[model samples]
Target: MIRGVRGATTVAENNDVEIIKATDELVKEMISKNHIAATDVAQVLISVTNDLDAVFPAAALRKIEGWSFVPVMCMQEIPVPNSLRKCIRVMMTVNTSIPQENINHIYLGNAVSLRPDLKAE
Candidate 1:
């Protein structure tokens, strides 16, 4: 079976370091919460708000040990009017038997406002 684990986070600025750090943190949390291994990941799709173009979020995944071969892509998020800014979002497709509803969707930092319902208490 295949499932998608979603996560989103916000960075304080558009700096490469901040973007990479936030992306790494968000993806790691998604993997940890879902008990997913790098090998189990089929692909990772990452999107960042237009304000964030300092770096490709996928760069963070490549730095993770064992994730060198994991397929990852990064793109710009749609600039919806009044949307959240400086946000990075990730959707990881993985081989898993876990039920969809049981999958944890993580939202951290200012990005929590993007999905208040999914934000951990």
Candidate 2:
């Protein structure tokens, strides 16, 4: 079966280094812990707040080992009033034999406070 893993993270600034580092770390952790290999990933969609540029995040994922084959796309999140700033959200679909509850959906850094209900237990 195919299962989806959802996660979101934030960057302290709009700088390229911070964006790349945070995105790489988040994607790496989700795939590694869930035993989801690049070949198994069906698609990876990333949405960044309108405040961010998508190039850095896309480049970050491509730089990672084995991620070259995975299809990735980036989009801008709608600017809702009072929304979080500098946020990067990722939705990934991968072929998995495990149940959804067994998956570890990551929310790290500033994004942790956003989803108090699902913080790492």
Candidate 3:
């Protein structure tokens, strides 16, 4: 069965380095927490707030080894009123035997406020 690993993180600024660094950190933490290897990831869809356009989150993900083969796409998040700012959210499709309930969803940095109910244990 396929499982989805969801995560979100906020970048301090809209720059290539900061966008890449923040995304890399969030992706790493999500993968580690879910025990997912790059080989298991089928694809990743990344959406960033409108204010963030310096770099694509997928580009940052490519900086990780073994991530080159995994299909990744980037889009702009809807700028809803009162929504989180400088936020980049990722939904990763993975080929895994684990059930959906057991999948770990990660929210880091200021993005943590976006999903407080699933706050990491």
TM-score of each: 0.95, 0.92, 0.94
Per residue, candidate 2 scores C-alpha lDDT tens digits across 1-121 of 9999988999888888888998999888787778788898999999999888745587878988888988999889999999889999999999999888887888988888778777654
**Per-residue error (Å), model 1, residue 67:** 0.3
- Kindly provide the TM-score of model 1 when superposed on the true structure, using C-alpha atoms: 0.95
Clashing pairs in 1: none
lDDT of 2 at 33: 74
Among the numbered candidates, top TM-score falls to 1
Judged by lDDT, which candidate is best?
A: 1
Worst 10 residues of 3 by lDDT: 112-121
User: Tens-digit lDDT track for model 1 on 13-81?
Assistant: 999999999999988889888999998988999999999988888999989889999998888999999
User: What is the C-alpha local distance difference test score of each model?
Assistant: 0.90, 0.86, 0.89
Ranking 1 against 2 by TM-score, winner? 1
Model 2 weakest 10-residue run by lDDT: 112-121
Reference-based lDDT, residue 55, model 3? 80
Error of 3 at 99 (Å): 2.2
Worst 10 residues of 1 by lDDT: 112-121
At residue 58, give the lDDT of candidate 2.
77
